[model samples]
Target: MAKRISQDQIAKELGVSQSLVSLVLNGRREGVAEESYKMIWAAALKQGYVPRGGMHPMHAPDVQHSYVGVVMRAGLALAAQSNTFSHVSHGLFTALQHLNISLAFLGGEGDLDETKLFEVVSRRDPLLGIVILGEVKEPFMQALGELELKLVSVYASSPGLCHSIVPNDKQSVEQLVDHLVALGHTRFAWLGGNAKLGRNRLRLAALKERLAARDLLLDDRYVVNAEGAERQDGFDCAAELMRRAEGQNMPTAWVCHNGLIARGGLQFAYLRGIKVPGEISIAAVDRTRACTEIHPYLTSAASDPELIGAEAAKLLRSQPEEIGQWNKMFIDLVAPSLFEAGETSATRPE
Candidate 1:
């Protein structure tokens, strides 16, 4: 068999002392500079240095003693099963795997039963941390707080409840508006869903703010509210907008809530014989695979669910002391969104 990689070799590669490498590998990160700690870990992973216990140094040296728990709120599970959320879960899973951490899906049922959650976690024996994938009611949050585990929440934010990682929806809306404005489209319509959903509200507010910054106004006549963010919502909303525009001048472009809505709107526009980007431009806020599945790739602001998931996992593994400092502090950890230009958006028609 090939020779196994050693901490000494890892230290040499990272230009740090062997003892420093040992400290990091052993999870004794006290007093180690963050940069050096990361460098040592990276080198160890790159060199394939398996510690004496058959675990990578990044893994808490006690191999079988600790496990991370993922708690999915029933409402969140529906979204989690979506293509975007699948990517997010994949990122979280991959990150934990690299750390040699096993994950337990504590609650099989989507409902957030405090008793069941408590029972599931209580049986996990020395649970390292918990990652909540969606919003939980106050009672549920209180139940989680009682557990006193290092907790990281994804896609949902509750003050003083847990560390949160969410997509920058406001920033995404701003980028989408900027893109459409630059393409010379002045009149715009927002195709969105329930205002009760925090993300939908944030996106709408951001869209108005961006439009106002450019001296453009979102007239009440141009806004269409659907039941939800599903594809059918998009289709219905698009049809409603078409009816509303029957006699009045049609908006030059439409900004959809997500790829599903975008697809539905695109389908409606095609069936109505409206030339995409020829007669009207279309854009959206998400970059899921559905964006490309449509006829003309959608012009959208994309949020990387995988990146957010990985970051959430990283927060879960952080020192308890660090997380303690964040408790009661309403911190918004927002990830940036990327804008991808596609055929659906173009200069305003003359």
Candidate 2:
């Protein structure tokens, strides 16, 4: 058998640091220049380096054959068609691909059967870890705890259960409220999702706290529950507000639950010949691509689903080697969202 070429040999041939060679071999090229990456691959090929795990020779031997399992809760899978969850999945997949790690998607639409999940994960032979997306029920979580596998949670968290990655919804709402208040808009109307949902409840509570600091309050009369965070729900709520404005004063600004609601509200306002920011300015608590792609770009506090996904991947990849330590490890990671002042928001009109 031919002598195996080591990473050190490749590094020497390319005249780059061994660390850089290791990163390239490990398929982590986030900060690596394209030119350098190409040279490294070329050098590895010429040196006849055999990567472990039966993957391409350029991949590191340790990870080439490893796999990670992504378990999406039934509820989240049902809503996976939506852009938000899809973006998160996309980011996760992208990172795994770059790492040259195979992925096994086990649960979706089945409520995550514990026995089946265990079987699927164990079948991987060389499974590196598992990532759970969305709210996983307690029973399922308990089942997972018995697995002795590295676990990472995304979009939901259970204290001392596993590492969690989620968006900073509270801060996002705070920033949006501050922007609206600075615009001299005192009277406010909230168009939000079902109040029972934890995320929506957090945003609502943050809004109230920020308003209270300014000696203002969110009028119950103006508050509308969308029930579902859909465009139609937003349109209906806006129509109701318009009707109420006929008999009483209207809020100077409308803070929507998300971009979809803002779009729906803007559509209704346009059809009614109500000028946006002229009659009523509009903003949203959650931002997505829809905000920027639509006309009159929505001013919104946007959370990057991709960033959340990437963070989850990072946490999983950097797990301690000892699976036992994961059970004792408690990680609460929050990725902050940014506010974009698009064309829709403006100073209060005189």
Which structure among the candidates has the greatest lDDT?
1
* Model 1 misplaced regions, further than 4 Å: 1-66, 76-83, 108-110, 323-331
- What residue pairs are clashing in model 2? 52-61
With candidate 2 superimposed using the best TM-score fit, by how many Å does residue 225's alpha carbon deviate from the native?
Answer: 1.4
- After TM-score superposition, what is the CA distance of residue 152 in candidate 2 from its true location, in Å? 2.0
Candidate 2: tens digits of C-alpha lDDT, residues 125-144? 56778888777677788788
Candidate 1: tens digits of C-alpha lDDT, residues 1-350? 87899888887776778999888878887899888887887677656566676533334545544578777755544443245666677788888887667777776225657767656554424677887776556677778877767778887887777888888888888888998888898889999864456778778888898999999999888788886677778899999998888888799889998888888898898899999989998898886787787469999896788898889888877775765564554355888999888889988988
